[model samples]
Target: MNLKVSKEAAEWYKNEMDLKQGDYIQYYVQLYGGIPTVHPNYSLGVSIGKAENIAIKDVVEGITFYFNSDDAWFLEEFDMEVVFEKEELEFIFHKK
Candidate 1:
């Protein structure tokens, strides 16, 4: 699995989330309310926190974006790319 964050997306997050260089962005599986490509009735969630067991990650603009080991089931079979589009951030999943 791979985690990729586009430069535009990283800038968007930095500005929108009011984050600094050392901040951590975590991507996790949430119950609902997003356009999820991997699982039905599920979606991705973003938060700022330190990782305990990072399975995959990408650093952009000095911010660390990652997925925890416990969320492997959601990402193990796909490459995730976060991009900025239409003035918002989008999550795209490419099946491995």
Candidate 2:
């Protein structure tokens, strides 16, 4: 999957860690698990994606990427466990 990083997110990352544009980021999302009307806790699952070359601000909503030609996802926050394995394709960031 190709993941795009926003300017704000990138800046925040740079300030928090020793990373650059081509670096891979690990992140998680909260999955609401509960009754239909009730909010549930987040159950995090690991997903791999790339960081695009776009600024967070440019991405008014959030970072969006394609898991496939017809499927895509937007990220709320970048997790810290997603890394590129030796055989994994690098997710590059794109500037908006």
TM-score for all models, in order of appearance: 0.91, 0.30
lDDT of 2 at 71: 23
For candidate 1, write residues 32-79 as lDDT tens digits: 875576788888878996947887889999999998888867887889
Candidate that scores best on lDDT:
1
For model 1, what is the alpha-carbon lDDT of residue 90? Answer: 84
What is the Å distance of residue 86 in model 1 from its true position? 2.2
lDDT of 2 at 93: 32
After superposition, candidate 2 runs with Cα above 4 Å error: 1-4, 29-39, 43-96
Backbone clash count for every predicted candidate, in the order shown? 0, 21
Alpha-carbon shift of residue 19 in model 1 (angstroms): 0.5
lDDT for predicted candidate 1 compared with the true structure = 0.87
lDDT string, candidate 2, 24-76, tens digits: 44433346632121113543332334654333222212333223221223322
lDDT of each: 0.87, 0.36
Q: How well does candidate 1 score on lDDT at residue 64?
A: 96
